[model samples]
Target chain A: MGELRLMKGNEAIAEAAIRAGCDGYFGYPITPQSEILEYLMAEKPYEKTGMVVLQAESEVASINMVYGGAGAGKMVMTTSSSPGVSLMQEGISYIAGAELPALLVNINRGGPGLGTIQPSQADYWQSTKGGGHGDYHLLVLAPASVQEMSDFVKLGFDLAFKYRNPVIIHSDGAIGQMMEKVVLFDPIPRRTDDEIKKQCPWATVGKTPDRKRSIITSLELDPGKQEQVNLRLQAKYRKMEAEEVRYEEIACDDAEYIFVAFGTSARICQKSIELARAKGYKVGLFRPITLYPFPVNPLRELSTKIKGILVVEMNAGQMIEDVKLAVSCSLKVEHYGRFGGIIPTPEEVTENLISKVIGG
Target chain B: MTEEIIIAGFGGQGVLSMGKILAYSGVMQNKEVSWMPSYGPEMRGGTANVTVIISDERISSPILNAYDTAIILNQQSLDKFESKVKPGGMLIFDPNGITRLPARKDITIYSIAAADEAGKLGILKVFNMIVLGGFLKLKPLVAPEFIHKGLEKSLPARHHKLIPDNEKAIEVGKDLIQPFTPAD
Candidate 1:
């Protein structure tokens, strides 16, 4: 209800985690995303809000802390850039297998090695598909602004718990480092411990006198039990597909050409839309909010109406393959982007769109 | 809804600070905004740049390839990005920073001697504010007052004493930009 205040994208994520009533935050310091840890350090919401923030020695330890806390059915979160997130793959896969409701944020940077500090959306496939080898997916929410960086924590937790799964907030250096005005929540979050407890009865802090001991583990050695667990997970994913698929169709209603992009890349695509529109090209953008349960059905439908689909990413056409799989080979698809810390500009995309699709 | 921009220069030349201030102004305007910096080891006293996206709506993405316009404090950044400047976009530069402006026919380039201006003002720390002031004076997407308030809020409380000097620095920066000339 108060006037909005300006905040950095990293600080925004920290605030959102606390506001989401997440009981704990475990993270290590990494540029672009370090402010998340710093914000938590400065705010220290522990005594007042019953939240715990720990700066782990490494990203691996941080995620295991998240695993430990989330296993007790407490709202928990951890964050890192691409390399650190890479270290967290094993934990993430374990969390997914255990069907735990937790959140992780990857403020992506350029990679293959310690590439550069600039923002890059190169972690697309790693986050959407399995970074850790297995048949699992993180409900990845891609944000283009600081507000989403803050708000997605709440949404991630809500959906994660709703589906009994782990969710990934896949942002990049752009979203993490940027500053924006955000209407921040009050000192205390809207949710309470009792509220979270009521929703998650399986939460294991210390068992009540009347209840039996609860064990949180992903291990199912028996073949039959593993199959049953996999089936249960598949069912949960099916439910998410049926009910939780989210995306935005910008100017696509009457569009002749569609540009598919997400996270920071999608923001540039909007600028491309403006440029293309001026050039008399009926260009539109399809931004996938959830990268995991990708808006496949809608993309397939759009393929039928659009002449071409241009998928722009920071990496070398990683997500383009997903778009192709979703829409099949009916429409001509192309990749227009950059890699290794180079950000693709609207002018470059505009040139590509005009030359390839607008009959240049 | 984003009013996107690029500010590029050598690392210590206060390039990131300009983007930070613009991003702060976006916050004061109550617009959804984000700031992204070159990640990894690019900050090792090298050609540093930042992109800021300020918008009114739930900004669809913070990532952009081309800027609406850009401000170059050094030649390396200009050389790196000048050709990629949009056909009709603006470029604010420091004469001390660049030997030659891009020869693009349609684009408008406003050259400022921000580094020298800061040196003359006896407030060198406000070098970034000078260009920020140029941004406001030339074509302010957000109100100047909003940015003024943003500076007050963004700077640390201990540095609040420097507010007057910084504001004055912006005022000086505003005077440096040549008023727009109409195309005959």
Candidate 2:
């Protein structure tokens, strides 16, 4: 109980970033998520914690700025909506390929192109799967509450540095714009330059007399060397898959049906679980906290106990593919969603559970 | 107790800020709270609405289809949200520019001339506060002291001097609200 305050998810993320001792935040404003940059600017963490907050000319410039700062062994991050995130795909791939520890937040809005400015989880395929042209994956975290929106900033940074890989906090407009009560953590002091040099020996912190000069780039013209780079990246992703799967099971012990969802959809499904249970239907919710290294094993285990899974999302059905693969297509796995920025109600989810999963 | 509330009005009517103050009050009282607004282009001169849920338990969905209470300011909001209130719920509104009034027989209805009252008081900005006062009169979810704390926390410190004025408007609202019986 450090400090209790009512905050929007975007505001909470900005506060948490500053409290996490983040070194820099470079972002271009976008609807539903412009609050992140707005809040940061208003707070002026540059004066408070000596953090650097810059409004880049565009999303491409923001991502490149993030790359530059991260390469210098500074804790750096950027936030954008779906369209802006699309502009940063190549940069994200470059960061991933360079093994730079950076954090990215995608407060997704409805999108195939420049979709509506309302909440949508339509970026599941683009975020968890490789959005850019590369053999890579961003460790994606899906925060279901404003509390997690605050908490995951530190967690994302920790995970990013642990694996030396970029991490994405896959959020949506609903979570980004909605307000909730949150207890903030105490501020962790920003790391000193010497501390960063000691922590990130691979960082481009200028030529040191004690060690070889570190070059930070994704380019490897030689085919054999590029293959080795791909192999190393693949092994790191596998290691993440083995250890980093995170999820939550609510009333799952006795459930006959499970609702698989993340972020805002998971919040709705929790209410649906209560509604369905009152009607004598045994249902539960399985929320994946980490979307990239999805909670595949636990869901596979839960699949043996449940009758079916309704993969609810704000998207048409992006995450359902992963849900299908997780369970090996052993049971009925259906998708219930409201795309184009429409959020399905809890009653609709309960109705879908009754008609689609149980009856259908 | 879980109270799901919707506050709807035109963009400049302070609908979102009223909900924010209420949610902040809940936070002051150690309750779980969430405020989800219908944002984007609709918030610019168009109808704006926010769904606020204050509960003792962890709130599940910030987005909701129905609410236990609806605070409607305009005719458009009343037409849209009057039916969305749960049966035996509460509907509070400011009847300043309304042709068609609420006809719901299941839920209890109350009308407060907050806009008119604020205009008469020569403080039109406190119109939402008047409505909030009316709401507290019906269902005192948060204490007055906590509301003071809420305003202090939600509003910028530069605006702290106006807390008493807002509180006075709330009192005016508490007196002005009248229980409505539909004219069949």
Candidate 3:
């Protein structure tokens, strides 16, 4: 019902960040995702909403800038591809350890090391399993469409602030570059400094007589305190797992087999389900909108009904591990993927489902 | 109804833009549409292609292996995508730089001398519009008014003056397209 426009996934993310009243965006340009920065620079949100859009020298500097902004209780974010995101791992770990609210977007490209500038979901492990280090977990939202790419900016920031944790919009090159119709939400005004101070009482907003001087750091010299911090982080992750598990089930009411996928792969499996059903196979699609939290309970319940599950991805098989863990190997779970930027087609997915699950 | 199409040609041949226009036109008609382009270094001077899907229902996948129609411009695209068209589908090409014609017997083949036509029109950039015009003639997926609106929406405001010229090229293209017949 809002403004409808045709936009690429990357452009939609940028526009959504601006409209979400994001206070700052510090990012480095990278292939497949440079459009996020390019669009921000072109739109000049600073002129409109007073949002600071900076092009840092590298991903490391950009993420550090995010740390600075987040510590000050500013709604801040940064986006990058796989290689660029790899450069920011240390910074990300520090932010997570510090419990700062920041939004990070990884428009994932093919990877192991600068693999390709094409779409891939290989970063599933790196994103959800704490790519940086420590016992921290980032709330990862995997958007399958350009529309969700726009919607998740606001949602990511909201969840980031809600849990005082970092949130990631884990997308891919295909969704980044692909154009689709999206209905944008109405613009929300950026919070004033006083509003931020009131909202984030723990933020390092300067020493005031009314409150204790806030210190922001991930370091704990004493082993006892560090263990407590790790325990607190684990508790928060468990809370997220219980409260924020988001997934979509299509035609699963009577399906004998299911395809579990996220992001671009989920969109492909939707079509594969249609094709499989046309050929008299009772197949369904289960798409995880939130990669973390894993959507384990619903999937486990569905596993009891379905005979098997085909875990499809753009990687050689990363999320498959999580899928297996979710179902506890109760049903035959198989993985079919195309790594290094190759996207599997609908026909290929359908054929794999038939051979790997039904016929095999 | 759903139409999955692939438009491929050299980077400068307006292959991506043509697909954008088609997608925008679909949007103008309040239809679900997606345009997924092949990006990166290969788009600089090499073959560039875009997969476009317009459907009355929600489109499931933007990346497809085969298409209902293929609008090809250069020979490289013809070589790569000729076999990717569905059997009994349609293949439309410029046939300007193509060395080997599409040899598929199952699909309908049509050639539009858009490059030569654009040369005669004294505006080479409108070559893609001519090809688009040829496509609309056969399929008529979108109406002319929506296309005018699509051109307005997709093209920058500075290029508004060129819409009439592009429309003229589309009209020229509608006339220039012909069914391909192989010589025995």
Candidate 4:
């Protein structure tokens, strides 16, 4: 077992990326996520771990750098907050169009246009629906705790490489600044160098003396080729949807009401469950670990037993739509959440449960 | 048995540290616990708050809409959350920070002079410490010794001297709050 220590969400992010064997980090400084950069700057892992850490002129350059590294099939990642994430959308789409594999972390803040610097989950559509453009998707993983924050680096990169697509670690500022005790992994089994070389043959590291030239371009004038490319990516997404969807079920066996939430919001919903159960209500919580490959079958099954489903979040009920789509009317599903940087307490959630589920 | 609560106040009021002590005590007692904070600009010297949920079960969803109990250290928080308190919920407030309240009389509100208490103790910074003490007395969530250990772990090495004073503040805060239905 690894040693446990107190760390902030951003520090955990930095350490987890290093532990996950990410080959490089190219990012610009942004609020809420600046600590991620600070952490990397202090660690200087490039010197010891042989990882390249570059402070780019802007998010554009950083994500482009990621594209460059990823074009060669190396594990690369970048971090940014809301506004900076908006700027990187173009690069993200480019990476997706080229079928490059990489990871991105967005420490979300309230925004329509630089709205505020408070925590928010408003980027759900932006992240899950391909914030950039075109018919594309990214595997989005939402974490609620520092421990999970540390683990997502490994999960995001693995999924990205496994699917030959980009993956996103979408967290709020709350998760970034939070201080908690985290047990970091030590010497976990890693992908072998030979495996990486095989997986990324199209990577753009200059061709060796005798090796064939590799090109990592997304442009294809032939419509047939573009269609074929999209079909391949779609097939991979389907596979992830079927096989990689993940979640945690709490007390749902005989639950009358189930509260659905993700990331930091899920932790409080759990408390609401316990509080409601004390008053003789059978409440459960289903926390989605994978936002994109949302665990659907389990939700369908639970919907049959529960009286109602409440999708709570820090946004204006972004994931609620997914829950409703998954259950498909087996149960009454609604949303009770906070937005514009306001977070609901357990008591308010308990009241929502009572008024909506218990009363309904 | 375990208890959970949220403490909220302005940035300088030390609400997060109060939750830290409670969580520390809970973990030391071999109970499962988690403490989460609201991040971003709101925490930069504005309204800083923390959620401490300790239990025997593997805790899920740290987000909460209601609190079993809460501590309010400023007028803004009282205005923000007085209505959200659970029916018959326990609320502890620094009387100096809050100037008003809701008309409903279900909650048990304790108005403490934590800042003044700390001032008397020669360390006004321990105001949140008193709130933790109040939490311990009111909820009995964990033993006092666990809190002392937690304080030891949470405090910076250089701030070690203040631990005893903070503990004293906790003792004082606990003594001031009224009892509640004991945890089973």
TM-score of each candidate structure, all chains considered together: 0.88, 0.99, 0.99, 0.83
Residue A115's lDDT within candidate 4 is 73
lDDT of 2 by residue, A123-169 (tens): 99999998998999999999999999999999999999999999999
Clashes of each: 15, 0, 0, 24
Q: Put down candidate 4 lDDT per residue, A1-360, tens digits, no spaces.
A: 786766778899999988888789999998888999889988898787788889999999999999988987788999998999999999999999988899999999888788777788999999998899888899999988898899888888888888879999999887787666678988443445667566667766567774578877778889999999889889988998998888898888888889998876787787788789999999998989888888889888878877888888888878988898899866788788788777677778889988976786
lDDT of 1: 0.81
Interface RMSD of each: 3.3, 0.6, 0.5, 3.1
Candidate 4 ranges with C-alpha deviation above 4 Å: A42-44, A179-181, A187-199, A275-283, A304-308, A327-332, A347-360, B38-41, B44-47, B65-69, B72-149, B157-184
Docking class of 3: high
Q: State what share of the real interface contacts each candidate retains.
A: 0.72, 0.86, 0.95, 0.70
* Native contact fraction (fnat) of model 2: 0.86
User: What range of 10 consecutive residues in model 4 chain A has the weakest lDDT sum?
Assistant: A187-196
Q: How does model 1 score on DockQ?
A: 0.50
- The CAPRI class of candidate 2 is high
Candidate 4: fnat, from 0 to 1?
0.70
